[model samples]
Target: MEAVSYSGLRKNLKHYLQQVNDDATTLLVTNRDNDDTAVVMSKRDYDSMTETLRIMSNPTLIDKIRRGKTQIAKGKTKQHELIEPDD
Candidate 1:
C-alpha cells in the first residue's frame, strides 16, 4: 500500500491510477480533515477481497473447507468425473 495526500492524488490522478492497476497495489488517500481517508485499489483486487469476505462470512462454507482439508490430509479422498454444463 501507498499513502498519498489528497491534493497529491488529485495532482497525479492518472499516474496513481495506472500504478494501482499495473502493480496491483492499493493507495491510501489521506486528508488533513478528520476521518476523510479513501482507498484506491484495482477492480480485480477489490472483487477478490469482497469474495473472500463473503466466503469468510459463511461459517458452513468455512467448516466444509476445513473438513475437506482434513479429509485430504487423512488420505480419504475420491475422484469424480467432471460435469460440464450444457451451453
Candidate 2:
C-alpha cells in the first residue's frame, strides 16, 4: 500500500494510476479535511478481495472450509464427484 495526499493524487493522477494498474499496488489517498481517506486498486484485486469478504461473511461456509482443510490435513478426504453429468 502507498499513501499520497489528495493534492498529490490530483497532481500525478496518471503516474499513480499507471503504478496501480501495472503492479497491483494499493493507493491510499488522505485528506486533511474531516480526516477523509480513499483507496485505489486494480479491478482484479478489488474483485478478489470482495469475493473473499463475501465468503468470510458466511459463518456456515467458513466453518465448512475449515473442516475441509482439517480433513485434508488428516488425510480423511475421499474421492468423489462434486457434480454429476447426465447424457
In candidate 1, stretches whose alpha carbon ends up further than 4 angstroms from where it belongs are 79-87
Best by lDDT: 1
Which pairs of residues collide in candidate 2? Answer: none
State in Å the error of residue 74, model 1.
1.2
Ten residues in a row with the worst lDDT in model 2?
30-39
At residue 25, what lDDT does model 2 achieve?
95
Instruction: List per-prediction Cα lDDT, in the order shown.
Output: 0.97, 0.94
lDDT of 1 by residue, 1-87 (tens): 799999999999999999999999999999997599999999999999999999999999999999999999999999999999999
